[model samples]
Target: MKQVTEKFRFGIDIGGTGIKAGVVSTENQILGQAYVPTGAERSWQEVVPDIVHAAEEALKDAGEFMENCISVGIGCPGTIDAQTGTVVYSNNLNWQNVPLAQELHRTFTQPVFISNDANCAALGEVCAGAAKGFQNVFMLTLGTGVGSGIIINGRIFEGGGPGGAEFGHTLLVEDGELCTCGRRGCLESYASATALIRQAKRTAKQAPNSLLCTLCKGDLSRMDGRIPFQAARQGDEAGQRVIREYIKHLAAGIANAVNIFRPQAVLLSGGISKEGTYLTDPLTALVAEEVFGKKNSFLPQIRAAELGNTAGMIGAANLSQ
Candidate 1:
C-alpha cells in the first residue's frame, strides 16, 4: 500500500512568442517550470498541441503526474470571459472564441481557469511581489505595446466586462502615430518600448553625429531602446533631449492613472522597465512635478515589478483558486 502525495497547482502563461508553465504549491512557490516557443506561425491549429506539451513538461519537472494535480490556470493576452473560460480574441496567436478552459479540462481532468495576462500579473504581484502587502495594485507592462492590469481588494477588478481597464488605449494625443488598433496617439504609440525604438531611429537618422548612429551600425532599424538610455548615462546631449520627451509622455500617462484609481502602488514591468532607477527615480520626480499637488498626494508610489517575466505564470496559477 502507498500513501497519497500532496496535490499541486499548475500555472501557464501564453504569449505571442512562447509559452511558460510552472507547478505551484499552496504557499505560492513555483516548484517547477517549462518553456516552449508558441509556434504561432504554424497557425492557431498547431498552437493548441504546443500548449499541452508545455504543461506536461512542467508537471514532469515537478515529479508529479497530471492525475496528482489539483487545478490549472492560464494567463493569456486578449479579452477573456472569465466566468465561461473563453478567450474572446488574441492578436498574437490570432485566436478567437478559443475554448481554452474546456480543452485543458478535457485533456487533464483538472479544474481550469482563464484570465488575461495583465490581470494574471496583477494577481501575482498582489499575491507574491512588490504589492504583496498592498490591497490595491496597478500594473503597467511597457513592451512592444502597453498592457495594463488593475487589482482591487486582491482580485482582478474588471469593472463589468473585459473592457474594464484598457488604460493603454486612453488617448494621449489626437492624430498622432498610427496604431494597430487603428487609433492615433494612444498611450502605446508614444511610450511603449517599441515606440521608443521607432522614435530613436527617426532621431538618429536626423542626428547622425550622436552615439545612436554608431550603435545602430548605420542600420537605423537595429536601434535598441537601451542605446539612448545608455547614452543618457554618459551625458550625451542628443540622448538627453530624446529621453526628456520620452519621460514627459510616460509621466503624463502615469499621472493620469494616479488621478483615476489612486492605487496603493503602481508596478511597472517588461523590457523597458529594466531602465531601473534611471527611469523609476526620474519618473517619480516628473510625475510629482506634473501631478497637480505639492505633497505627492495625487500620485501613487511607483515601483518596478518584482516578478518580472514569471509574473504571467505565477498569476495564471493563482487564477485556478
Candidate 2:
C-alpha cells in the first residue's frame, strides 16, 4: 500500500485594485504570500493570467510546486455562483458571468473553488480569527462601503442561491442619502467609511473652526473615518456628533441582523475597526440597547476581526475542504 503525502492549499483573494495569493497550511497558517496589481480595466483574458502568475510566485515563495498543492480557492467580490464558479456581477470589477473556477482549473491541475470575498472573510474569521470558537457569526467590513458575510453551522450561508447576506443594503431611512447601489437610505449610506467621511466634510463646511476641519488642514478631502473618532476623543463637538450619528445607524443595522440571525458573534473588520475600544465599546453598548428582545435573550458578542485583510485568503484556501 502507498502512503499519502500531506499537501497544502492555494488561496487567492481578488480585488479591484489588487490580487493576493497565498500558500496555506491545513492549520490555517500562511506559508507564503504574493501580491499583484489587478489591472481590472483589462479583459479577463489579460487579468486571469496575472492571477495564475501570482499563484506560481506564491508557491515559489513557499518552496513548493503545483504538485504540493491539494487545491485552489478564489474569493472574489461579486455575485458569485458557487455551483458554476462564475461571477454573476461585480460592480467594482465590472465583471459579468466570468467562468473564474474553470479558468483557474485550466491553469492548475488541482480542484478550484470560488465564492464571494465577503463570505470568504467571514469564513476565515470563523476558522482562525475573532470568531474561531463560534459556530454562527456575522461579519461586517466597514470600508469604502459596507460588506457583510454570514456563517451558519460553520458554513458560509448564501441563502437560496447566491448573494444573500447583504446587510449593508438594508433600508435604514426612507428617501435618505443615495447609495452606490443607486438606492436611497441604505445602511451603507450612513454606516460606511465613505458615509463617515461625507458627514465629516459636510459638518466641517458648516463649522470651519471645528477640530475635524483643523485636523484636515482646512481640506475636506483630507478628512477620513479616523478624523471624526480622533476629534471626538479630543472633545470636538462636531466630531462627537459625527461619531454618535455613525454609531446610531451602525447599531441599527447590527441590531436588525442580530434580530434575524441571532449569531453567536458579530465581527467587524476594516480600517475603522482599528479604533479598538473607541469603536467597539460604544458600538457594543448601542447594539445591546437596540437589539430586539435583548432584555430577555442572549446578545451576540461584538468584536474586531483578528485576521484583518488575510481573512479572505485564509477562507478561500479552505473552500476546497
Candidate 3:
C-alpha cells in the first residue's frame, strides 16, 4: 500500500467588522491564524478575495500549503442553506443568495462547507472548549446582539433547516422593547450588550448625580455595558437596578431554553461573559428558580465559554469532519 500523509484543515469565521481564519491540525488545535477587516459595506465579490487571502496567510503561518489542506469550513453570519453551501441572507454583510462554498472551492481544490456562525460556536465548544465532554449543550453569545447555538447528542441542532435555531429571536416579553429584528421583546432586546448599554443610558439620564452618570462624565452617550457593572460595584443604586433587571430578563430567557432542551450545560460567551462570576452567579440562581421541577431534576451548569472568539473558527474548521 502507498504511504499516506495526514492533512490539515482551514476554518474561517466571518464577522461584520472582520474575518478570521485558522489552520487546524487533526488534533483540533489551531496551528496558525490570520485576520482581516471585513469591510462588509462592499459586495460579496469584493470580500471573497479577502477571505481567500486570510486563509493563505494562515496557511503560511502554519508553514503549510494548500495541497496539504483536506478541506475548508466557514462560519458565517446569516441564514445558510448548508446543504447547498449558500448564504440565503445576512443582514450584517448585506449578502443574499451567494454561492459561498462554490466560490471558495474555485480557489482551492479542497471541499468547502459552511454553517451559521452561532452554530459553529456551539460545535467548537463541543470539540475542545468548555463543553468538551458534554453531549448536550446550549450557548449564548451576548454582543451587539444575542447569538445562540444548540447541540444535542454531540451534534449541532440546526432544526428543520440550516438556519432554524434562532433562540435570540425568541419572544421573551410581549409589547416590550423593540428589537433590531423589528420585533417586540425578543431575548436579544433584553439580554444583549446593546440592550445593557441602552438600559444603563436610560438609568443614567434619570439619575444624573449617580456614579453611573459620573462614569460617563455626565455624558449619557458615553455609557457602555461596563458602566452599569462598574456603577453597581460602587454601590450605586441606579446602576444596581440596571444590572438587576438585566439579570432578571436574561435568566428568564435562559430558563425558558432550559425548560425545553434541558441540556447538560449552558455556556455564555461574547464580551459580556467577561464579567465571569458576576454574571453567571446571579444568572444561575435566577435560572434555577424558573426551571421546571428544579428540585426533582438536575439543572444544567451555566459556564463561561473557554474559547472566546476562537470557538467559531475552531468549530467552522471541524465542520468538514
| lDDT of every predicted structure (CA atoms) | 0.82, 0.89, 0.90
TM-score for each predicted model, relative to the true structure: 0.92, 0.96, 0.95
Residue 301 lDDT in model 2?
A: 86
Worst ten in a row by lDDT for model 2:
1-10
Please give, for residues 1-321, the per-residue lDDT of candidate 3 as tens digits: 113434788989999999999998888888889999999999999999999999999987787767889789999998888889999999999999999999988898888989899989998998999999899999999999998999988877877886588899999999999998899999999999999999999888889899999999967888888889989988999999999999999999999999999999999998888888999999999999899997467799999999988999999987853
Candidate 2 on 223-321: residue-level lDDT in tens? 988999999999999999999999889888999999988999999899998988788888889888888876477788899999988999999998853
- The number of the candidate with the highest lDDT is 3
Please estimate how well model 3 matches the true structure, expressed as its whole-model Cα lDDT.
0.90
Q: Give the Cα error of residue 196 in candidate 3, in Å.
A: 0.6
| Residues 1-321, model 1: lDDT tens digits | 123345777889999889998988767788778999998777665787778899888877777767767778899998888888888888888888888887776687878998889989988888888889887888899988888988877788765776567888888878988876789998888888888888888888888988866777888877888988887788877777778878888888888887787788888888778888888898888888776574547567888899988888888887853
Q: Clashing pairs in model 1?
A: none
Clashing pairs in 3: none
* Pairs in clash, predicted candidate 2: none
Model 3 scores a TM of 0.95
Q: Which ten residues in a row have the lowest lDDT in candidate 1?
A: 1-10
